[model samples]
Every structure is written in structure tokens, then in C-alpha cells.
Target: MDNLAAEQATDWRIDWQAPWLAALRELGQQAHGLVQAGATVASGLQYVKQAHGLLPGWQFVDQQQLPVGQAYEAFICNQRCIPTRNNLHDFFNGLIWLHWPNLKQQLNALQAGEIESQGVGAQRGRLRDSITVLDENGGLLLAPQALCDALREKRWQDLFVHQRELWAQAQFLPIGHALLEKLVQPRKAITAHVICVPMVQAPAMCTVEAADAWLSEQLRSASCNLVNKPYLPIPVLGIPGWCLQNQNFSFYDDSLVFRASRTA
Candidate 1:
């Protein structure tokens, strides 16, 4: 993320006000290269000062080491890599970086290439489009397995309506703010990877393999894809209160996501 912070750190006030952006809040603007008034972004990454390499060539630099507003942009970049338990935002980003370093590098490379070639403009090319797609819709919802089953099976009444207690079991692991935002307010064609974190018996525990298997299964047939063959497709819009407001159980009263639109 090229922090276009040309002005002195003291001159500009970055938006650190997003409450739901909890993880980012923990890292602060400086970590992600926003370069707020007081903090300067990292310029030179000191390998000795960093933790073990998370990506092949990239390592986690202590947020403290980075200068607030440094003009440093590279495929293998430095970041304030904290433990996931420490902060959700950093955790997910770190996980993504680890899982798909090449993709991340490619996207960043493309974004930079676009700026160099296209400059700041109204339209963007494919790489930017892919990055934006992943940035916005490219998120996963990590919930209890039972809750995931409810969603996958399209058990709207059991999941959202009749099963009041089940709602409490739902947990959204910080995949990405955009994904979370989409959950908060759904829209058409907005798809997310679902990671069913098991909150049940040991035998049926959720594993990465299981989640990947489910994803593959769903993709194999549109009939299996919840978004494609939705028993109720309002899920395409979102989990409810996503755009208009925060995720609220109260919003369920008039929720379009689980609002039994059919005569089930």
C-alpha cells in the first residue's frame, strides 16, 4: 500500500477513527503506511531487527522500528508483524501474506505498475480490479461449524430466526475488514470464503483441510454453491446491517439476509 504521504507527518491527520477496524486500530496508521501526524512509516527494513521470515523474502519488522513516513516500496516489504492474538487486522493480513505471498506480491506489483502506466485516473485495469475484488469481497468468515452448516444448508429459519441461541455461536474471525464489512452489509456477487471454526465435539473438529474441501465441493457445482443455489439468496446482499449499520441482533427484526422471503 503506497502511502502517498508526501507532506510532513505532522501536516496530515490519517483516519484512525474506524472502530470496527479493530486490528488496524491496534497497529495504528503508521504500521500500514498511512503515516499519521506523529508517526513516520518505515523507510529501510533492518533484517536483524525483524522476526522470523513470514513470507519467503519478507519479514516482520517491529512497528516501532519503522519511521512514520518513509518512501519505501518493494515487492518484499516490511510490516509491523504482531501475533494474531495481539490484533485481528495484523493477524489476517499476516495470514494472507503467508498463505499467498506470490499473489500478494503480484497484486502489489500490478497496483504499482498501474500507477506508473495509468497514473491516477477514473478507471483501473484487470490487476487493480482483481486486487479490489480480493480487498473487498476476498474475505473469509470463520464461524462455528454448526453456524456454517446452517448457512451452507440454507437453514434460514433454524440459523437466524428460530435458533436465537445459535446466533451467539457465530464468530467472524478477522479475515479482512472489507469481508467483515461485506458481512455487515451484503451486496450482489459478493462472495467470501467460509472457514468453519468448530465449536463442538472433538471428532467433528474443523481443520484447514475440511474447510478447503468444503470450498472445493461448493465450487464444483453451482448447485452446491450457497451464493449460486441459495435456498434464500438475500445472503448476496449481506448478513444484515452491513451497509446501513453495524451487525445488530435487533436488525434481525427487519433483516433482509434472513428475512424469510419465501413461504418455507
Candidate 2:
């Protein structure tokens, strides 16, 4: 069997109750229910499009629908359909599109614009590479300046332990579909390239829709700086309340996963 078919045959399960998946539980459960009913990724996404009334007229189409020699982003931009495979990767991608349509649209536009300026070259160039990284493994970190500073500086102990209570005031949303897929089988080394959102007020007060809107604006304003990969590597499990292993103070002692900041 081909890779896609093999992947479809695999029994895929998502524990929505998992602490790591708490942030995405609502949407995850919806998608999980559809998949459990034996819906393919494209079909499930089509259902979501109808139910949620997804904007920009984006629809999920089979990967085969994507023409040969056509870039995925460019195709989505021109055709208004996302090429999806029947796998966990595309399943989570569909869920993200439902939750953050504006962000997904913006990312696609940036990618398509890049491809237009510079044809599908062997090298994707800096902007395209950065955009891909964000789409695949990014996180949105809405926290106070202090917590953000601690994280950006690689002060794991300060950010995850000392300021543990502060986490209640913050919100960290996993924006990358690949990151969500990886968390299905929780691992200690699972990290996210967290983009810090500038918000002094407690993020817990902001609704999911409000947070999504704020994040979309932030990304739009900083599209250029993305080329520099201005993101902090965060060991997601270390976040307080996300994992049982991290409850102990010694969890941050692993230098391999939570490495110290490099010298200038």
C-alpha cells in the first residue's frame, strides 16, 4: 500500500482529556468525533466548513486534487481549497483551520506571495522557510513582559518554576498542526517555537476569539521579522499544570532538553 493509504489504515486516536491538549480540547473533540464516525480528513473538514461557516471560502480537498508541479500554498491561494491527506497531520491541520482561519489565511497568502516573486526554487529562501516553521511548529504565548522576557532569555527555571503562578495569568496556544500531532504521544523533548504576544493584561481574561484576533494582527505586523526566526524555543511540557513530570523542581535539570542560553 502507498504511504497515504497506510497512514489511513493506522488507528489514530486523540485523547482530548490529555493535559497537553487542554487548550485545543473543544476543537479536538469535535474533529475526533467526526473521525471516529469514519470520515476522511477532507470530508470531516467539509463538515466543519458547513457547520462553522469557515471564512475565505476555504475547503479541504483530497491531496490528489493538487495538480502536479503546483505548490501547495499557491494552489490553496488560487483554488481556495486545502489539499488534505487522510492522516493525523491533515486532521490536525483541518482543526487548526477551523479555530484560526484568519491566521491560516495570512500564512497562506505570505507563502503564495513568496512563491509568486521567486518561482518554486530548490531553496525556499528565508521568508518561506520561516513561514513553514511557524505553520508546522509554532506556539502563541500571551503573557506579561516579565514572563515573556524570562522565556526569551532561556530562563527555564524562572519561567516554569519560579513564576509558576504567573502562568495562570498567561495563555499559550499551540498554533502548529505538526506540534499538535506530536503531542498525541506526549514526549519530554517536545518543544514549540513560541511567538510571544505583547499583552500586559492577564491573558486568561481574553476569550479564544479575542486571542485569535490579537494573534492574527501580531503576525501580520511582524511578517518581515519572521525571517530572523524571532521565536523562543519552549519546552511545552515544562509549563506548570501541563505535565505530571514537571511538578517536581528537578524536571528542569535536564540540560539536553532545556539548554541554557548561548553566550554572545
Candidate 3:
């Protein structure tokens, strides 16, 4: 389907009982505030991970090869990831540093061995709602109270009604098929930097246009010989290699940044 048509069909109707239905608005506001404060992109994401754990499906991995730091676990069924526990912890970690600067030093001292990295089992309370929303093909069509119960009790593992509907409609079109296939693909994640931003500094960010320009220029100036080229071309023909259309970038408050990893 065309972009306009797809958007029209993409209902923003809230399922009232969705776990985040109440806090979604506030999340938006807080994210915006962080952006306006000149927080870097990484910082904003860290903030969200803390405020709404696992909801956005983010995961954190440290670049270093320490067994504990290298591969932190996350739940990314299909192509979506909920969010990183490390980052959520980092939000509080940063706070502790603010109150007692020495605490950061103490933590850093144990960075290699002292920090214990482990997986947080998907919280049953939150997962219940997610599974419900994504499971029942007709779950979303049910009464708000019924839906609320499913979400509250963590009973959302059934076929998500909305996703099922999307899959059905997508089956008829090649493009839809391709998109759905991509969405369903098993996730392959990598370790990348997590730039942390505080809630206080996420508002007065560079305009999208300005950031785009800046990022493009940064890419253009990179030494082509360097294996790590900054920008990639979007999968479109007849476009210059330098066109900054290949990747996706977003903002949370004023803190918006992109992931650059050892692989890239």
C-alpha cells in the first residue's frame, strides 16, 4: 500500500487497557523535555529505557569482550526489541553518580569484574499485556474491561489481534508480504555504544533538518578509505551515495542519536 493509504489504515485508536495507555502521554512529554535540553540521542534512549522498561524493546551491549559485558540478554521476538536493562540501570547509575561522584569511580573500578551482568526474565506483569495485545486476532475488538483484565494479568500471549489482521491483509500484496516477512525475521543483534542522556537535558535539540545536514556533512567528510563509513545510501536507484536516506534516526526530547557499532 502507498504511504498515505497505509497511514490512513494505521489506526491510532488506543486499546484503553493497553498497559501504557495511561502513561504514553507523559512519556512523550518527558522525552520531549530531554531533547530540548540538548541531551545527545543516546542519552534520551537510556532515559526511556529506565522510565518504561522493556516496552520499547531496546537492548544494551558493551563493546568490550568481557563475558559479562559482551552479550546482555534481551527479548526481541521477531524484529522488535523491548529495551535494554543495562540502560535502565544506567539511568539510576547516572543518578547515583550525580549525588555521590565517588560512586561512579567505585563502579568504574569494578567495571571489568565487579559489575554482575544478568538477564531479567520478562516481567510477567508487563509481558501479559503485550502478549494479549499481540495475540488474539480479535482481542483488540473486545470490551475495554476484558482487554484490561488480560493486560493486567499478563495473559497476552495469544495471537495478537492487530498483528494477525496486518498479516492477513499483507498476504495479498507483494510489498506487504515483504514488509511482514521482514518484521517476522529473527533478530540478529550486535553490540553498540549507549550514549546516555538525562531527563533534564533533552529539549533544545537541533532541528531535524539541521541534524540531517550535520550528519550528512559528517558522512561526506569521512575518509572513504576508512572501513567505517558514516552514512549509507537508502535502497533507491539513481541516488548519489552521499544521500543521507539509508538509515533511521529519531529523537526523545532533545536527546536523539544514532547507533554506531564496531560492525558498521
Candidate 4:
């Protein structure tokens, strides 16, 4: 299948989040029972992470020499959030935040050990998927070199300010994907590309549509190819409270509760 189709298909299992919870509880119970019964529990933890998104609480180093920890499982609450965990019970128990207290408080509680770890690591990334947009002149604005140049020049302070303002007003749209070679020089002109990060917002249902629209328009203006699927959810670790006020957020299923919505 093509890249666009591939990315969309990757989320096929997301819908299973609802029903799989019960079965996962059983599996975790059995595995913990087995581990408590003297089994090493290596494979069992992997099983739990796979079935439930709970990881074994370990680490792996990438080529960049950065250490990446394992998360048990991941779920998309909206277009731009996924929280991973290492334990099944802790992951499920987080659902309690949906009713009382608030997600932020729950997360704080989880961090403070008021909630269990479930062996999951919170891994979040930016720039969820790609999109293509058209500039006012109808020319594809293919040069991210401008952004790169701005960064190298230490003009990021200005750029960030501008981007932050634009993001406040614009929503991104998804376009189809192009080949990797299309992302580079010479051949990049062959087809347009759209890359986008969601307009960060709070964890509420009302903001969902607005966030989606702003992202779409911004991506289209940039002449990039929008991926057309749900925006890739970024993890909300250490993100400023203001950013979360309007964008969708989710981490581990239990933490998928909605936040207060913002007005346009």
C-alpha cells in the first residue's frame, strides 16, 4: 500500500481500545499472578504492553545516543495526543479521571505515585503527519529552508512568536503523501508536501472541530501535503498549560478525559 494508506491503517487497532480493556485486565491478572507465582515475567510484560500498552520499564538507546524508554501501549484521544504506560492496572485505573477531579490533577497524582506506574513511559513527538497547501501566488511554498535559516540565525524567537500567533488563528488540513525523494531538492518540486503540527489546545470535545479546521487551512497555505488522517497526537509532557487549553490531549486510556473548551 502507499504511505498515506499505511499511516491510516496503522491506527486500525485504535477502535479496539474499548473492548480490549476487559480482556487486558484478565491477561494482566493472569500474568501478574504468574509472575507473583515465581515466573520471570519478561514475556508477560511484553504481552501486556502489546495488548494493553503497558511496557516493562526499560531503556534503549538510539543511533543519536539518546535513551528511549518503552511504553506499554498507546491510544489516540483526539488528533494530537497519546500517553504510554508500562502497567495494565495503572493504565486502566487512570480512567477514573474522566469522572472527578481533572486530567491534569490525575496526571500529577500518577506522577506522585497516587496512581500506579504500570511500567509505561510517556513518549510524545511533534509534527504528527504531512499535508500540502497552496500559497497566495498559487506556487507551492516548498522551502522549509526559510524556517531552517531562521532557526540557524537565532531568529527562532521571532519565528516562534509569529508561528504561535498564526497557530492561534489557523487550523491545519491533511493532504495525501508524496514520495520521500519528493521531500528533498529538485524532485521535491515534482509534487507538493504538507507537514503540520496540531494547534495545541485543551482536552475538550468542543475544540476538536476548530483545531482540525485551523490545522487544515494552515497546511494548505504552506503547499504541503496533508496526510488526511487524524493528526498525529503529540504527548503533553511538560507542555505549557496554555497550549493544552484548546488542543486535544490523551495519554494512556485512563487519562483520555476531556478538558475545558476554548472559544475561537
Candidate 5:
């Protein structure tokens, strides 16, 4: 495809108004402008950096700027710049950096520390693997105690239908860049490794900045060992009001998508 055609094609893939993008709506709109203007990923990063006033030292450079042998995380830590590509994956990644700089920085630090101490071995080790999962396909679920319990137990009917009203007081922020890319063409089985953050009351009053702060703090704490993957499997599209088809009570009946929990 021609350059303009390819850009337009990519632009259409992103529904800026999608419910999953609610938290990122403003940044998404600004980034869409860069896409519409035909700015390359590297240049787009510069625009967002200046417009949004991102981290002082960090910048986005072309993927080619990455050396042949250096690890990606190592490069980011040593050089303070991200090796970005011209694709949706990198695009969403940049948006994540814009929205959650602290969380991204924390993950990068953990990864780099692992590489520094362990070297890039055949296996990424538990903490590094967990960090990768969070960076690529993680989510933050803010909900009441009951809602969190329903999700942990895989109680689809109770989570989505029986206690549907509870969703109004809850929020699910998609943190993984790969997850955001996949959501561009949403599917029934698109699940998120959700870290449940139980709230005393509804999180309706919470702000994006507040959420970012809280999540960053959690990752920085000593208990950040994610080896066991302390995340719940939540089929994101099934969240009430996220997908039009899910409005029907029977939407959760598909065992294929909402599988029952495995027993010991």
C-alpha cells in the first residue's frame, strides 16, 4: 500500500471512542493526530514528549538505533531512549509511556536489573517473565471486594449478569501494549492478566493519575514478586458495556470464552 493508504488503514484500526480506551481517550486522540499527519513513530514520540511533557531524559528513537547485541531493556536503561518501531505495538507502547511513565519505568528497571545480575540467559527467570507479561498483556482491575471475588473464582454469570450494576463502580485499565493492539480488533476470548485492586467503595471517583500512582507504588513495593502470576483471567470484552453484544444476558453462556475455573 502507498504511504498515505497504509497510514489511513492503520488509523482506522483504532477506535478512539472504544470503552477500553476510556482512560486513554485524550492521549489516543492526540496520538491519532500524529498518525493522521503521517508522522513516523520516532517523530510521533517527539511530538508527544513535547506536548505531554514526558520524562525528561527519555526519548523514542528508531528501532535501528538499537545495537545488534544489546538487550532491549538494557538499551533503554543505559541510553534512556526506547527503540520504537512503526507499528501498532510500538504505538500503543508509546501511549503507555505517556500515560504511565512511573509504571513503565518500574518495569524497565526490574528487567534491566535482572539482565545485569543474571545476564540474558536462555530463560528470562520468573520476575522478568512476569514483568514481560505485565508490559505486554497486563491490566489493572479496580473493583469492590465482591466483584474481585467473583472474577478470581471465574464466576462469569455473577460478575457480568447477576451483579452487573457493580461494574458502574469499577474500572479495568488495560496496561499491556500488546493487549491494546489486540483490542483494536476485539474478540470474545481476549483476556487480560488482571491485578485486582479492591476498593472500599466504587472507584468511580478515581482519576487516571491516581490509578497510575497507586499501581506504580505496588510494583515498587517489596511484594512485587509476580512469579506465580497473581492475576485473574478476565475476558475483557465481556465486561458490561464494553461490547454491544455483551449487553444480552446470554452473552456469558459461551463456555468457550468464559471457561470454568480449573480445579486442583
Candidate 6:
């Protein structure tokens, strides 16, 4: 299915008892207003560029205020993105900008470079396509290198079973509703583009406060290359404690939200 059809099919409707649900709902409400106002996804992006809020290293600006050029090229050049009432696609894009502006800018930079070099084509190549796919429907895990190593290697006992404390130190920020939806009924496709942020400072024992603090720090720290080249995506189900439906430390394993990446 295309982006819009899939978005229509998606349950962007959040009914969570999560701590971060308020923020998610706030963004949803903002984007929902546009949709309710009879906005189409594509045109909806054009409408919300009226802000001047400073987010980390970037500032929100209208595309009309930017230099004249191809639409995508102009957006990239100005280091800007739009929020659309259009489908969950751009709405989620806007949500990401609200939640993680620095990363959104980074992704836009990469996309701009592609458009600049490739003459703003109607289509995208693998790198650009992969990046777009990732932005639209990716989940991110932020943890130190060692914890990541164990998770990647499926060292479940060491990571979640024996030393469960190590597993809690990480952050799970799902990028797309589709990713979360897929978690309810997981398919390999939903597991396709997992993004990792290597935070050496993350504590061994993850607390809600520490995770929040670390994410805040990441948000402020000047943009970094959050993903690697060729994008080594991880299996969403394979997140150590995430899919292990058994006794010992079953908070994640037994939870219905196995696919829910808690992106605060």
C-alpha cells in the first residue's frame, strides 16, 4: 500500500496508560486540528510553517520565506520541515520534529543533500529511500555500546535474565505508529529499520528519570551521526526482554506493548 492508504489503515489513535502519553496526545491534538480543518496531507505541510520556535540548532520558518528553488530542495536548504494534516505520514513527521528536532534536521540534511545532488527527482534511491522509510516508520534504541552488543548478539540471559539492570539503561523511541501497530501483530517489515543512538553516558540501571535526562541531553547536544552507514536495522522482537514471554522479569516480555517503543 502507499503511504496514505497505510496511514489511513494505521491506528494512530493512542490509548496508552504510559507516562509519555500526555505529550503524544498533545502533538496528536495539534496535528488533528489540521486534519479536522479539512486539510490534505500534502497541502497540510504547507500550512503549519508559521512558527518561529527555536528547536536546538534549528528554527521553524515558512517555506515561502526560503530561497526560491525546487520545493524539496527549498525545504532542505532552509533546514525546514512541514507538519501536514495529511495522513499519519507527515503528522508523524511533525511529531518527530516536536519530539526530536535535532534528529529531524539531520535527516532533512541528508535528504537535502540527495535532492541537491540528484536534481530533486520525482523518485529516491536506496540511501534516500531507506532514510525516508526509516524516518516514517523506524524505532530507536538509545544505550551504551556494551548493552547494545549484548542485545544485538541475542545474549538474552546476560542482558535481561541474569543482569536485567543492564537492559533498563536503554531508551526505546518508536519513530512510527506503523512500527507500534506492527508490534501488536509483529511482522518482519515493522522490524526493518531500527535506529540506535550510542550514548556512552547512559547509566547501567535505567530509571524513568535517567532515561528522560539522557534523552534531554541528546536533544541539546549538537546533532550527531545517530545512525551508521548502510543502516544495520535490528529486529523489534529481538530486543532481549521485549519478546521473551516467560517468567523471570516479565515486565517487557509479558507486556502487551512489546512493539511500543517509548519515545518521550
Against the true structure, candidate 4 has what lDDT? 0.28
What is candidate 5's lDDT per residue for 1-264, written digit by digit as tens? 248645653666688889988888887777767766777776777687877777788898888899999999999999999998778888889888888888898889989999999999999999898888889999888898889999988888999999999999888888999999999999999998988878864254287677777777767885555778778889999998899999987899999999898951
Ranking of models by lDDT: 5, 2, 6, 1, 4, 3
* Cα lDDT of model 6 by residue, 92-207, tens digit: 55555666554566566767776778866767776677666667666566776776665555454455556656556666666654554454454433354554656664444244
Candidate 2, residues 1-264, lDDT tens digits: the string is 355555553467677787657766776677666766666678767886788676546788889999998899999999999999888898888778887788888889989999999988999999889888889999778897889989888888899888888888787888889998998888999999988865754344366566667667766998438889878899888988888989998999999999999951
Q: Tell me the lDDT of model 4 at 76.
A: 21
TM-score for each predicted model, relative to the true structure: 0.40, 0.91, 0.19, 0.19, 0.93, 0.56
Which structure among the candidates has the greatest TM-score?
5
Distance from true location, Cα of 173 in model 3, Å: 28
Q: Name the lDDT value of residue 189 in candidate 3.
A: 22
Which of the predicted structures, 1 or 5, would earn the higher TM-score when compared with the native?
5
TM-score of model 5 (CA atoms): 0.93
lDDT of each: 0.41, 0.81, 0.26, 0.28, 0.84, 0.51
Give per-residue CA lDDT, model 4, range 1-264, as digits (tens): 235433432322222222112223354354455434433334333344455443223221111222244221221211112242322222222222121112223223323231133423242212121111211001111113433243234343332343334323432221221221121122201322223232233222233234334433444364323234322222212111223332332221222321121331
Q: Model 2's lDDT to the true fold? A: 0.81
Give per-residue CA lDDT, model 1, range 171-230, as digits (tens): 432333355444333343454544343465323324433433443344344323332222
Q: What TM-score does candidate 6 reach?
A: 0.56
User: In each prediction, how many residue pairs overlap at the backbone (N, C-alpha, C within less than 3 A)?
Assistant: 13, 0, 41, 53, 0, 1
Candidate 4, run of 10 with poorest lDDT:
134-143
Give the Cα error of residue 63 in candidate 6, in Å: 13
